[model samples]
Target: MTKWSTIASSLSPDKMFLMKQAMEQLDTRYDEQESMVWGEEGQHDTRESAHYALGLLLRGSLEDVQMASGIIDRVLEMQLTQQGEIYEGTFRASPEQQAPPSGYTAWGTFSPGYGYAQQDALTEVYRRFAQYAQLEEQTQYKEQFGRAADEVFPRVWESFDPNWREFIACTFAVILENFEDRLSIKQVARMDKAMQRAVSTSLERYVSQSIPTNTNIELMHLFIAHYYGHRYEQIDWIQHAERGAMALLDDYRELHSFAEFNSSTYYGVDLTVLGMWRVYGRSVSFRNIGLQLEHGLWEDIAAFYSPAMENICGPFARSYENEITSHSSIGVLLYLALGESKRHLTSINCETSHDLLIALFGVDVPEAALQQLREQQGERFAVRQFKELCERDLPGHNRHVCTATAWLSPQLMIGGLTGSHNTNGQMHHATAHWLDEQGRRYSMRMVRREVGQSWNTHLRGMTFNVETEVSRLDITAHLEAAVPIELVFELEGAALHEIQITADRWQLPGLTVQVDAQAPQPQVIQQGGRAEIVYAVEHRDRIWNQMHFRLYFL
Candidate 1:
């Protein structure tokens, strides 16, 4: 096991300062919350906050540790109030007092959703707090911690859904291994029962043909089998786990990083879990393979880090907003905390946990890399490109798309194929943008297409070809159906200035023109440097099948 001292003394002064600042910022955020929510206000994810608290306790200062303890205690206290299925969360503020967040909350009004890490964290909180209470000679608090563990155990085990997430399963197995002996005799019996359930569920997931091909899930099943096989003395579990691990090794050899969306976050999550298996698994091969996977993932992720944005700049095949910091933080925690060797310690500032850096990744960054990062931070413009087949399963199988992402200093640009099969219609168009230093997004222009007749049914298998230059973007949309269509070009962003549009060879009768005879007249609506241009074309002609729109940003 790696000691915090080894990592601590080796950290650089500049890196140390940033880590401290991040930890202080996290502490201040929790302090401001009357009760902790998720990253944003009005929402709380059981797992997200739980993991945050785990990171805090593992790497936080004394005060931060105490603060995390209180947060976990509050969660345990909340868990105690439930009688039926274990609801994942509680609204710290009632709707009458503060409006509930719009759309579905994580578990939807405390429904017994997939327990995942929430259940694991609830148990972990009790386990950790009991240790703290014992250290302080607080018999009352120790009893309270134990009692809370018992209160949460049945709910966690009973509500467990095997089909949901593999990481949660890994957490569950670890918890049982660590704390099972400490429980009461009755609780031990309950733990045994839960183990049996996990084995059966895991087996089902392992052998199922229809399950998506995911590296993490596959490796997770192997780890679970290895752990429980020993506990239950089942030879079949061990054999299955070994086979599963070997299969993953083969896939990794071919794919390097296996197919998945949001490589930074998902890969980080998988690597952390693999680190757990490396520590827990008996087979040396599993650990060896895990380390190789770690190196590949780190190299890939580090390339995307833009010191200018202090975030993972993207041509992300599958992307989300808030996970950039969290994903990078998970990597720092796992690699520095557990890896045998501390090679290049790059991308330390990307994580938000100062304590994690000092305790896990290390307090010191390499002088040369640190200098380079600072130098890049001062530069005005930068551009990056990723030209590879990024395979994803969301829209379909073997779905790898060629995409490009560029960072023009404060501006970030991502361009790629539009999502044809997207049910939500969120990413149905080609988009590119740059974020100014203020974190405001500015796009040159965005083109969205709407087919008037049978649009929904006709959308299947459609494709868009986008050609882009330094100062211009041309989008040629192939809509095979001869249906009326409208192309909407929205120039959006806070940094947009002096917005103006002039279309050539296009007739504009208030932006209405026939699809065959003339290009639609561009209707420009401008307000404060943000403008929307609407073009309507509904003529029956073969040319309408291929509609082209060009825009220039000066």
Candidate 2:
């Protein structure tokens, strides 16, 4: 085992600080918030959501989890809905009492990622202690866990808001995933259908967005969370994975770019992969999708990695050279395809997508082939890299998941409980994942051929590079600048990374550098005819946070 329990340190110190910054953006109950941005009050998510977070914090420290548990029980008592369903949230305030927010509330909710890390922190602590449910493991931790679970377990279901079904699904996924982690297979097999029903129903409802599922960040971390849990056995989760792959493949074949395949977005194709295939490992059909995509049928998704890798040809051309490394839904499906088809997907560049293709093809490719592929990954790749807003939390270039969320991708984690806004721009999408994960030292790599800039009127990128002997991270550019030239940069400080933008260029966004404390801000890194510009800081710990920019002067 890896010496660390992921749950215990889910939230890095840096993340905790960012969350504090975000919370500060709001008008908490402690503040009257009379003159708030939306000219309103507390946010929509703070009511019952705070309790879960608060309970977790208190549960870890207080010998008696009872205080939090009692509060949880009281909340559950509010759930008039039946055992398996919810129709509303536990916390309620008039719309008049609620203020929307000054900036995008969805983005603001994360502040710097404290709220996000807090969840992981609480979860880790609780899971570690949960095993003491016998109330027998007399460690101080056990007593606290026992008290918390005892009080909360009985009443949590009641407190869950029906309208917040997405959150419910997220909670259920965790419960199930943790149960699997702690219980025997036989024990897991014994969970009644009612539980599954609850999960599926919640996910379906969440994807549909018929209710309030969103908590923040491109819908929230639930999207990534959905993928980590165990796959379905009694059900057809594998089939779902296969179908999603096929549909995406089919769409990519018809459409030149994956950016056009909006169906999978709503259907939660990635989510299904998590819920049914990755954990369960049953989706035999999905293996083919990677094969098809590798065949170069869909350029958009392929652009994320494919031709840029070392492999010159697609997976069909070679297999042995490419190696897939991701545990994501797409990665799992691609591996399935490669194993079935015996193809290899090598990196046209460093992206896992290219890795997926190589795994699918299964061949030893020529170095020349990879060189040729990179040569071809020109402007289209640059544009793909350029069309982003900038995420401050993502340690590197990911602002990845969506073309829509762009820079906000850093706020996204790998689960389904997190969702994004609808086309109408409402933060209505919330998801639930299929698994429970622990640990966070992450490294995400994608392919980019620096398409240089010209006098095109809009600058496509800015440079943000950092490579210390201890830490390695960067957010560079591949500009396909259009009307408004935006200097893109990579910002990493806390544990995560994000993208940052300087609005008018007059006021350079500046802040204290976390990595090299001696590094002064507003210290004249000229861009957009401005001084040092600052970005959103997620946490103050992890003293290595830095922002590297790629200036774009179109």
Candidate 3:
């Protein structure tokens, strides 16, 4: 560990401290049972804990190895069957049935998607353990891991489409790498054929329908496809992957900037897989492209990070508010530094990071880019990027408008009003988004006109025709009904500014909220500096697109 001075020298002092804090916390967050809680008294989930341990184990500290091994063992012990299929428990007990962990409002359920992810985590941990564990423990765990894979891998392959899950695709890639010879030779051969077929079928089906939404997932598919024995499919999928990567890069380049996309978390997913490709992919040209993209993304991502606050205080065009500035935000710079130099730096700790430190050793990166990373600290660089964020367009399906921020010396405030990115649920009218300095969020939602309305109302699709500027944000909605509706804004520390109503318009700060077929009679109530606005409109056949609205922060 002391030999890592070269790596340590690459990070600024602030990042070094953050890395220390992250790793120390990872040490404490696990219990004696090795269950990972969200906090000291948070709910214990086998899946989340496994992920944490996977990264910790790669830290190569004696204490980390012990903690990670304990977690992997406990996760192996918790696999249970429901409906003739194996799934890891959400807790040590039936977390689904048990009360929520202390201080939590509710418990969690085991979903097929999450179940697939947990199994992937276990297999990944086992893969790493097999490589580095002592002989006897290694053999024992290998046999246990093999049996788990035999049960879960087929089911996971059968139950989920690989195209939809990059996590599983990447997991499959790992299985291909690690499970050989450890399992019964005959079983390994058969499993390989089956997984190869499954991955191929899903890749074909997915490409036929749509381009890959995630770069990381596509890279996994490419890595597997390129090396798979099916030469024709290998070449075919590799071309497909290359095309997709080009398009994604083009999308960002056209904007001349990056959008956080729908979730801030995907940033990590992209970096991790790209880092994996650069490390493991056989082609030099592709690895170089990956390295370039990795460096560019790190620069952009770090620009949002404020070392002063140790948070990603964002002007993200689209992101889940809860994760906007989470303490456990993605470790882009940490991973990039590891990917570039292949030296594992203790100063590069991030809770969600995995075996890339060990796995990607000696992978080459451009000296210029590595030098740039070695020189960065957040606040000064981020302050400049704060200006860039305001000038640039971080577009996402046109569903979310641009972001606006106010940098008040030491504090940063970001806000954006957006509609749902996924259309699986009923159409929401409008969601007003705001994130204050402390990561406190304020979102306002209006119940859709579809509630209690006929299912045919759902046939009426909605679009987000919202717009934004540096100081203001606006949203508009068109409903099938002309009647006035109630809009609810969930507030933390926000207050009402001004509210008024007339026959034709409900007035706020910047614009009017209107519905056709009847004049809107709006009511404004202010309580404790916070306000709620309710208005009624005449019964009309539709709330046309012209019902422009602006949110007023009180």
Candidate 4:
């Protein structure tokens, strides 16, 4: 059997199902006339097209290969080739749009962050195209790929960020190790020069700075780079990587959690990078470490996942969206592990499509983790985890962070973090999920609001003392600054009789919330199919720094 088929045969039926479903989804997104995938917003995205091409290449039929080749040709044409320009080496964000020159500042705009084009999009194209050349039997495809490399390799030196630099270097290493015969002397020379630059720059950074553990996704990329550097006999890169990896492993050993703990989006990046190390690392020690970390990470994800609620219980350190149905990279892995019953609860979109690369390279999740996800029903459990935050400026001193007591029962799951130093406002410190009488899932969470600014929901320096029982939660929140806030209860699928409010309490279909602070009356705002019960907490006379509330599951 071919390598892809061999791996496919080894996958469990559920995983195979997930792979097939993902492929079909990609196929549906393809625009036959354009030879690319159109994003949800009706614009053509280069990275999304590259991911679709990779999926098609993996499917590996004659027609699929032809289509994938065409998509790749279109993607390569999108590269910005004007030398001396800021984005010269990067692909365009779209055919009509260039990345914002100011880098990450223009997020949520028509011209978005530079990383989408410069780092992530280019890396995806190069890695996926390299795999295509490796797997195709035809010599013409390999030659075309080599010429494409000639065009792209000279630009690798343009990437300066540690994570992006390492990503390009690792891809170059893979191409050199596997497809050296196809590359011309000029292409190889250019790639090696770029690779050396990345290595030397990385070595200097590692020597001068303490290795960071707080951003778990970027840490994995650095580890992968170190593994490749070691394989290619770069002594300093491997040394620092080994020391950093060992220290990170020690932290996980103590807490059974990551510093960037319980992130629904970034965990997928972590898992994929570990899988790459496990599959590609030549060193046995690195491979073993990857396996160990991957297994532990999977176990943590299983523990937090609620089968009844169809989502992971959070005190999410970072999350882009509140609902699993919106979009989650880890949701792809969960669907693979848990099977078709969860199909409706998970989402796969253009941005997360490249995560399918994990399946292309095999990832072996532990059987124990799989069992936990499958058998979580009718189980009542509680989890407490601790992690340390590295103060980048204050090297030696680390801040201790305690995750909230997560209580999971058959009908409900609730959790929060004791506190967070997250400045990006992605932290969901306290959240609850439960099913109503009609079996529709409902959610509630605490959010900070600036005085007179109801739309402001940035969570920063908020601390919580949260305790959970079988059907109740007691939460006391300490704000760093005195601010008006609200407990926003999402009532998406509720009927009129399912909600009732008294003076200081709220009665929902499945939950009763008792407020302890003097606050304004509750407001119910309806927007389309969704409604929110905004229970506001406002301080008038003096600056009260603390607020207390209780939740009882009915």
Ordered from best to worst TM-score, the candidate numbers read 4, 1, 3, 2
lDDT of 1 by residue, 223-283 (tens): 7778878778888888887777776666556644454433454555566556666566767
> Candidate 3 residues 481-537, lDDT tens each?
322233333222343355464444444443344533222344555665444544333
In angstroms, the error of model 4 at 166 is 6.4
Worst 10 residues of 4 by lDDT: 104-113
C-alpha-based local distance difference test score of model 4? 0.59
lDDT of 2 at 434: 11
**lDDT (CA) for every model shown?**
0.44, 0.28, 0.41, 0.59
Candidate 1 residue spans exceeding 4 A from truth: 1-165, 177-189, 211-216, 326-460, 464-554
Task: Compare the candidates by lDDT and give the number of the best one.
Answer: 4
In candidate 3, stretches whose alpha carbon ends up further than 4 angstroms from where it belongs are 1-165, 172-195, 210-216, 227-233, 257-262, 302-318, 325-328, 331-412, 415-460, 479-488, 492-547, 551-554
Clashes of each: 12, 106, 5, 0
Query: Tens digits of per-residue lDDT for model 4 on 44-86?
Result: 7666676666666555566766786677567656554443333
Supply candidate 1's per-residue lDDT for 299: 45
Task: Give candidate 2's root-mean-square deviation (CA, Å).
Answer: 20.8
Tell me the TM-score of each prediction against the true structure. 0.51, 0.29, 0.49, 0.71
Model 3: lowest-lDDT 10 consecutive positions: 385-394
